[model samples]
Target chain A: MAGYSNDHIASLVRPDQVHRDVYEDPDLFDLEMDRIFGRSWVYVGHESQVPEPGDFFCTRVGLQPVVMSRHSDGTVYVVYNRCAHRGVKVVNEECGNVGRFMCMYHGWTYDTNGDLDFVTQSEGYPDLEFDKLEHGMGRVARWESHHGFVFANLSPDGPGLREWLGENSDFLDDVAVSAPDGEVEVTGGVHRYLYHGNWKMQVENLIDMYHPAYSHESSSAKGGQQFSRREGDKGGIQFFEKRGKVKSMDGLGTHALPNGHTWQGGLPPVENMSEDHRAYVALLEEKHGPNRTREILIKKRHNVIFYPNMAMQELNPHIRVIRPLAVDRTEIFIYPVKLKGAPEKMFRDQLINLNRTHSPTSLVQTDDVEAFTRAQEGMMTSGNEWVLLARTGPQESLESGRIRTTGTSEEGMRNHYRAWLEYMCADRPE
Target chain B: MTKNNRSGDNQSAFGELLFVREVEQFLFYEVGLLDDRRFEDWTDLFTEDGYYWAPAEINQPDPASGVSLFFDDVPMMRIRFARLRHPRVHSQIPPSRTSHSISNVTAKRSGTGDRVEVEARFQMLDYRPGHDQRAFGGKYEYVLSRGDGGRFRIASKKAVIINCDDVHLPVAVPF
Candidate 1:
């Protein structure tokens, strides 16, 4: 809105790199909230979050405050949080079951599917141009779910969630089908952090496997010591650290997909995975054949970026959502994913791993936070105008409708910016 | 008969007072060790099978199912301490400077004479080189037990942080 022309914006992004202003200029940031996030399919809460009728979870699509609610008829709705009367947010709380979202300002109530259920003084006001049916809660343009993960798009005319997801849908299927019953529930409260960096920094770091080796050296070293002991030697000392450690290019590769979704695969199996896999395979053998079960069990990938704002880690068992507060400040919400029909100990182990690796007090996240903060600081420098995305690789390879690169190549980041540039270059209203 | 009874009661009362004093001194010494960054000495204050926990949510009773800010037994604690001291732990590259102030201390005997339940409110000011100084206030719930040489050692320490459910800053060190 602050007067950056489309031609100038298009010039900022090249095939292999992006200009620094993409992360800095407040004008571009505001425009992005309108163009890219305003049109793209952004991840809403999971279906399991609002399992029962009338349950709701408050979240955001771009900078707009929205709520994902479940109706009595088993349908999910993503509605603008604003009340029809005074434009105030209808739901004040984070998440709970509510019969109706009654605006505190004037007591106007809207139903779970975001329909105006009641009015404070219906009889007092004459129905002129405004009708009760017309004044129902404002809804998002489109809402859809893939493998129980709901996504909302703010713009009315665009690709459906499936078309946009494209090849990335398989990665999501891998996560959901890994559950013995082909379902996952969002259990345990979300771990939220206010990061002092850009939202893209977090998204970029999702598949950036190169940084962990340097950033998390201390944690990996200590983990090695703890996991070096024999299994069952000490209670609660699983080879978690060893499983989480980054091995040197052990069958590692990155896959780039349409819509900027990229996945990093080939992580070494976590210790004791075979035992869990055997159990899962046995349970799923009746419904799914041994081959399918093997595929589900052996699908150990670190992370897959859903672009725009969300990333899901299959092995670590968590989904991370980024809410961009400002050009500089962002809030990261991490939710633990519980694979249904798996061993209860599996859920407990995943929770423990989250506590160890992702929590604010954890050694790994602390290092990441520090590095991101430093990156934010460095971006403000006048010395450099561009941030390099061209990592050393022998030209990206296109195989079977997917781009493949070395384990540590920056091709994934380049894929992200390409989609970003496309979205930002779209026609704007003003 | 009357004189012996009175004398015996007085000795028992004196012994209870001495136990409380020892518990207070032990807690204070532990705080000093943490402030001094003497992690090795700090960990030594715990009993062999003791626990160090900081519940992720308020009043989280157990760490088995729910996530925790910290839920470390001995080995995990060792890893945490070693990571803090490791050179490549970039988060602690400059290392955090902290001063812990604990007050409102209260100690009482639990089920048996060997165990004591101590509660204290604490405020810690932590500063890293570039980051702004942060004040973390919490309540410490400690279950202490008498170990060898009649010295009090922590059996469990649970740090309950106030107004920090959705933590924004890095809790790099123990609260």
Candidate 2:
């Protein structure tokens, strides 16, 4: 914004096309970190991640380090990871339990709720200069949670997390009710992969059903035959049509919700008769009754992107946090979601499936990473300046302001740019 | 070939050394198949119910307990290798070339059945055109059974990379 005006920023985004600078420019990347990630309800770690008081998990909101800790009063707090003195990062470990976060430099300490507790050599500093309340590890402007998922905002002016989540809230609710205990927990372990591409590439790919048939053909088909992704899967989603042409995934449908949220309709049902599956269904039946159980077992949605930072899939039951390292470097952390009170074997199967689908060596995702890295390098071409997103179909508008389109439609990516322009061009107090 | 002769003798010690050397040669050949990109042939070295596991977590109790980089059973291995052969496999366009090195080899005969438990340290240098070269090092644990004609087949091969928990780029090849 220093050299470019608001009009220049608006010029970068079109209704169906966006300038490659959105993915490649360092200047625009900085603006995104400030306007989009800085103001939005960026996802912090889940509540279940720090179940005990004083437990903390260090993560990043954009490029700045932040900590999410549970206080003794049972409240979860998101605060800057910087120390009150000298700006040193206070927490070095990924996640751990500590009574107080003591800065290694000069030994300043802070409470679990990020309140500055102790500072050594107090006599050397003027009491008037160092106010305790003003010097603690800085908390984010606002923090909130829905069903144990925590999101923190660096700005206080944006809509509340619920209002921002919009219709995606129903996606979360569907996930919760599908579980036996009517809850879900982020646990077991995380599977992570890094790609030499922009962070938004992963988010947009989540709802883009068109690419899978081409990008993931290796994993889904071989020697003119389609293979099941899971060992016991009856048949995976058909990538090739009966006439040897690539099948369009439009039938599954795609939804472009407000504020950049997007989701794809449920994947075709695959075969699984494992005891764990039966037992999980039985548990849901006992709670919701036989008729309601049938509805619960049917997946309501597949991949749901929560825009800018996070995405989750009900199919494999995991959340992928897209942490942008730089304009061109991004790290994606995938945490397997466990349905509370379901058979442990079901969770085990989920982990196994994710290993094959989401891990760095994942058969399915490796090709996706390949596409992303190539796109990052190819976008440097001055040959064609604009990256296209112009695919369309019969659009249906929902009462909640969400637009539904064909699964292969590029509406999802267009929706993201719509929100992107809104954020990048919005007036901010200097 | 009797248990009576396999106890506390110089001959038994010599026999154990010979067996370990034989297992090392077998391990070398198995890795060679991968290096040569004879992936389908690599599956032949596995037993009927054999598996290749690369645990994602350190000291992972079992494949079921935690996620793994790979947990391919024999059937999965066939499917994986078949995919690798697909010409349109974008991840394998330039095709990852790997040089595998095995060291610190140790082996012990199991008390029951004609099985040997082998552990070896391994490092693999993998490279694809226009991509950063990566080195993957790990400890390989194998439960190998001696089959007909005294052939050794892998019942299970677990490659526990030292940096298993670290974030990694797409690894198209097994370590």
DockQ of each: 0.58, 0.63
- Candidate 1 residues A142-203, lDDT tens each? 89998889999888877899899987787788777878888889887767777788889888
lDDT, candidate 2, equals 0.88
Off by over 4 Å in 1: A127-133, A221-251, A271-278, A395-400, B1-18
Specify the highest-DockQ model's number: 2
The candidate scoring highest on lDDT is: 2
TM-score of chain A of 2: 0.97
Docking class of 1: medium
lDDT of candidate 2 over A200-277, digit per residue (tens):
898888888889878887777434225465435776566876777887888888898899999887854547668878
The prediction achieving the highest TM-score against the true structure is: 2
Model 2 CAPRI quality: medium
Supply the TM-score for candidate 2: 0.96
For candidate 1, the TM-score of chain A alone relative to the native chain A: 0.91
